[model samples]
Target: MSNPLPFLKNETPVNWFWVDVSTQNLRVMKAAHETVRYPISTALNGLGERRNSACTPRGWHQVRAKIGAGLPANAILRGRRWTGDCYDASRDPDENGHQDWILGRILWLSGMESGFNRGGYCDTFRRYIYIHG
Candidate 1:
């Protein structure tokens, strides 16, 4: 958190994003300090970097890539590809409609620290930890 002010600059020298699991908040920040915050839910399992932990890794991360930029809101996606369908609010989720989807905008994250959130079995990218949906 040292020098956290740099993350607020309207003209950022670096591109980065932050996920605060404690508060369930995602901060889309970095060079366009056009920062935006959104509510998020982390790992269905818990917190950790180990693969299959189903946990959200800790430490610094970057938006390695973006997906579904133009997809409609609540558009259902399967395995990162649009399922050619959108969520029907009238239908219940138990009806097998867009229960857990990585739809809308997806920002794949890669770890910035070695042996922690990155590298070996703790690699976030390998772990498929992302700021998605």
Candidate 2:
């Protein structure tokens, strides 16, 4: 069977975190290690309290859950299921009218502390959404 922990095998036992917003690129950081960054596209018309769908949330979050762990890279995902096809954003025409596709992997985010990003409107956990490749 394919190893689900593919990303973890290469590095030491360090914690990993990531940040992505509509305006900026995706940033992944591993504790005591170099950070990996990539450009991303967010919601176009701005969604939620963030006001702008393009604006990424600002706060502290943890990977509450990781999905599609062992799936092949670029595998199409919908409703969190693998469609058995690799996806290339640049090559595939946008069928959903959105340029973003959370594929291959998903990081479920949860707020760390209360008030700031925990409860109320700023809750990241309750607003759980998939983040893809």
Candidate 3:
């Protein structure tokens, strides 16, 4: 694994979030030291960089924007905007739960590396990849 620092000096310590897909875990790191960990769910189709692949993209990324700043938890969002609704069991009355819902706060991510997860079809920003509660 390589350390990814964007615009920050190497000697300067900072906090970052590491999403370990294989372990289904997310960890908070301060200067390469783990501070906290949490469980996370990834895509059903696994990992990829193609559009509509229904997979998680790999590589370094930075948060491009934060959405739903003042919204309550489980706030339903569509097209990156709050739909003025919140999630409930009634939302999935059929219990199939096949719908992909973007809820709560969102951290829109943009890939940093070119020709991989950044430019063209691999662009994470255009793909609408996000980290949310």
Against the unseen true structure, what C-alpha lDDT does each candidate score?
0.74, 0.63, 0.85
Q: lDDT for model 1, on a 0 to 1 scale? A: 0.74
Clashing pairs in 3: none
Q: Candidate 2: minimum summed lDDT over ten consecutive residues — where?
A: 46-55
Query: lDDT-based ranking, best first?
Result: 3, 1, 2
Candidate 1 collision pairs:
12-31
User: Which ten residues in a row are the worst by lDDT in model 1?
Assistant: 4-13
Give the C-alpha lDDT of model 2.
0.63
How does candidate 3 score on lDDT? 0.85
Quote the positional error of residue 26 for candidate 1 in Å: 1.5
Candidate 3 lDDT over 1-133, as tens digits, reads 5556554544544778888998999888998899999999989899998888888999878899999988989999888899999998667643684776789889999987777888898899899999987
Question: After TM-score superposition, what is the CA distance of residue 6 in candidate 3 from its true location, in Å?
Answer: 7.6
Best by TM-score: 3
Cα lDDT tens digits, model 1, 1-133, are: 5554343453445665667778888777776573788898887777888977878788767677787888997887777788888876574665755466666767788887777877999999887666666
